[model samples]
Target: MKDIPEGCMKKRGILFTDRQQDTLTIAGLSLQERMIRTLQKAGISEIFLLPQQSEEAIASLQSTSGPVVCLTTSLLLDPRLIEEFLDFPAETTEGLLCVVPRREQPLFPLPAWSAPADDTVPLPLFLCPPPLLPLLVEALQQGVQSFPALFTYLQERTKIRPRPNEGRFWYWVRGPGDVKEAEDALFQTLVKETDSPITRLIARKISLRISRLLMSTPITPNQITLFCLGIGLIGAFLFTIPHPLAQIGGALLFLLSTILDGCDGEIARLKFLESRYGGWLDLLCDNVVHVGLFLGIAIGLYRQYQVPFYLLLGGLAVFGVVASVATVCYVTLRRKKGSGPFFTSVVNEEEAKRLKPGFHLLVKINDLLARRDFSYLLVLLALLRKMDWFLWGGAIGSNLFFFSLLGIYRWGRAL
Candidate 1:
């Protein structure tokens, strides 16, 4: 949640549409559906499709109850970007905002004055307040048909600060090519900034394809999460067998688990099925698989070499992993004031700013070490007949991870 600016009024969504244009399909979903889903995810209080919704929404819009976000079906953009835009720190509740291309120099702190528009340029989105809704209704009654004419009319009455679209995404679906462009923007959601090299270059490519196919089916994201969790646990059990062949097989299965781990998120994001329970489940399942693999490796090594040290190393790894999970949960629920996010960064970004310079660098490296990319290395070691080496290194590294987080919790500004 963010701090609300004084006089900030919540906005309802008004999606102006042409029935034919709105019916145009992208990835099996209609454009209207996509637009509505985007607004829903952004926490819009009420969403109405105009022309279709004019009779009902106009009365509500005319009452001065709240502002409304007006956009048309002719355009599409990154939903995440719209979410951020809605949360942009506008100094006043009534100031208008015009969405423009990223190539334009956009005003920051939204309520600031915008550069003069060329008038020939077309804008794709708007933040229309209640005062303008009646005039909008009047314009509609008086034969203002093209959305551009209505936008021009509205801007002439009140100034609109330009809010530039983020990223290389905002598309106007005027032709077949534009719809394809919009689809490309939608697919871009599969790529995450936090992705590690292996996961980004390899695992993500595979998982995204799998997610695309699964999105057409009845299987839910949580189901994929549980299925992958089962696969991971089975692989861990295989790690307990003493044979070299078994070790290699277990490592292979483990790698598969790690790769598919991204699929659940991909599917959830694609269909807008993301949930708090799913996030918590993903985190818990990953940790369980991690602990299982550590214990299994120790047992397998002990059975093969008859060394008690393997068991001790296993205990250390398990302790480290459990302690780390508990610490993260504590920080998320207690310190951060909310939960349900995947624990990608052990230290939160805002919290990182307050740490001493030396500790900040150390925390960044530790956080990088925690990414799942190392799963690829474990498989490589297995192929080299070096499973014991992985066990040794992972044991030490896991303990180090816990201690790093513990230090942050105890001394850093926040964990």
Candidate 2:
């Protein structure tokens, strides 16, 4: 997709119609605020709001640039739909008076100059040249009070285009049920586009619920990271106790920490609160937890059996964990240096297919060994009182997996 120029739509103002009390609560934001935010995100900096009670509302909704296109508030518009207007070819947009249409009757009032239903079932969105504002006012004075009517008038008097609805997702925020649906749609959009299988199948759902409960609060993503870090450390400490019950507790806590870890990212994406510092903090905390947990398990096993081998095995496990992280960093840095940060190629299907078959096989193997989903196996081992087996498998498997990954990456580069 071609990148839309930043602030391309700022010159063309947005007009929002329909102002109702119920429109105030969609996604916990007032209709005016929602419209403004949606438009701003889509690179439309100027907005012309025409709420009900035109005289008083106009005074408050006054833009420094003045009203450009009058629109309705009862409709929740997807920003992408507005982006389409900004992306149209210059010739198509020149002197263009366009109305986006939906088949269903809109919850909000159509503009006084709207065309008839037979002409076009106009949505509460319009884009027109600023010069056309006077003609619109004249039509309104002549008792032309519907978007379809205005459209017909424009078609006869000027070159007007009726943009057909192309199945873009939009909602009428008419009541509580609509509000819930809008919120769910927004939440789904905020979910990370790339997620681990475990995250998608389990952790994300739980985390999303938690994130929604806390998103409106003062709590920030960094705070959630700190909370996850604390829980992880406590879980690691619990793993140091030489008892089956303690091991089970540690396992459960670790699982809880993993689930909670997702919430910080969820909240960050949902609230548009993502930050460089938050990303680094999350990475650092995860590594800390991994190191602590590996060492704790080793120490606990050594204490239980009074064996030096367990301590040595623990050291190897810690080394493997560190090496896995270092390998990924090294690969990412190398890719950045060579191809200007194609780190996404690690997950990109076309890039993966470009690799040699041997490397692809190793990649598949690494997925099974190194995925976060592997944590479930550890939890099972802990529950089964097979910590010794888990330690040995984790130490050997993790090192082998990462080393294999490094080798495969190099081989792919050579090919």
Candidate 3:
């Protein structure tokens, strides 16, 4: 049952006052502040702000003429706030509302208020449930827009997945019942690409060709691993050359290596070629080639300039190698233990359903990366080189640490 009048939905203002003096230590302030901004953008004008005080509560509402809702942290878990609103003249109380954190016991010892048995007007005694942000906006919109259609709309749009761009754990940050719109945006993009004939033809054709080649050859996954390693080394060698043509050659070689990386896997899968040695070899080759390719480029550039950038370039190479090694180790460990690989899951139909309507078009945005392997690393390396050496190094360091922990945990679990 709702605690507010069903018809009064618009012209609503939510008063957000925090008990904590220091904003820095507030656990979820970043998320709460984001929510506040979202509300403001929705055009709710009068957002009353105050430190915690029982007496000023009423005065706060009196100052705002529109419907007023009180938002307090756990410290303001007082029931009298609700009783005070109930005691006010019904017309004023009609717009007064209080939102408090949930508790095991009643927050205030005030007398309980009740509606006449048949009265349909809801009271303002809602609990400020944690993680309710997603649902709150939708619920408010439904209740405000149409009371009868609220439940139906909610049932249809209840479950949501994280946006691809938001990375991981995005859902945890959203208040309960709120959809991660950023994720939703990406979903839409992915969906629109489903209709592109070019994407379907290319994705299928490449995948099939690779499969057939693998079937015809006795080339083991280890050999595929070696092939990629050689390609990557050559790419690196080309990168060290001083000419623009050499750099272009290096990029093309790296791209070819990336494409072949996918081909090997397709061949293996199509030919029923599966082996533990192959998987591990693939992992080893990935780190070797990627690091070799980037390092070759960095050293090549250094040889040309002979500048202080040698250290920075070297740092990127070392850190990038460490990061790739860590990520591969972690992923391998996770796979052995039947756990998810960090940062991504195997794309499937379930993922397809979770995608938003407008964003799926991005799937067909082809590049050298549109295949089975981790070619995304190459692009990142290029961008990092252009942007800043420190950024490149930092990205490598962070990725290593992040994936290392996952690997360690999975390794422990395996034992």
Task: Please report the candidate that would top TM-score against the real structure.
Answer: 1
Give the residue spans of candidate 1 off by over 4 A: 1-9, 87-99, 102-121, 130-134, 140-146, 166-168, 175-180, 335-340
Query: Predicted candidate 2: what Cα RMSD to the true structure?
Result: 7.1
The lDDT ranking, best first, is 1, 2, 3
Query: How big is the positional error of residue 373 in model 2, measured in Å on the Cα after superposition?
Result: 2.1
lDDT tens digits, residue span 178-249, model 3: 223432321222222232344334434453455444544566656876887898789778867766667656
Query: By the lDDT metric, which is better: model 1 or model 3?
Result: 1
Provide the overall lDDT of each model, using Cα atoms, as 2-decimal numbers: 0.72, 0.64, 0.42
Give one digit per residue, the lDDT tens place, for model 2 in 1-415: 1233443333434343544443566544666667666676666645544323334323322222222444555566667776775555544432343344544544444354456464555565666554454555555545554445655666567665556556565666665557677778777865554566777888889988987888668788889989988888898898899999998888888888888888877676555455656765776677678888888899899989999999898888888888877776665554443211122233346558678766776676665554456567778999899999988986897688667867776777522
Write model 1 residue lDDT over 1-415, tens digit each, in one string: 1233455555787777877678887654677787787778777878877666666665555543455677777666566666666665435444345555333432212222345564323345676654455666676565554555666666666666666555535566765656665676667767988887777789988887777677668888789889988988988898899987888888888889988888888777766777778888898898999999999999998998999999999998899889888888777766543323557687777787778667877787787887777788888888887888888888888888888887876877654
Q: What are the TM-scores, per candidate, against the unseen true structure?
A: 0.86, 0.69, 0.38
Error of 1 at 20 (Å): 2.6
Off by over 4 Å in 3: 1-207, 334-415
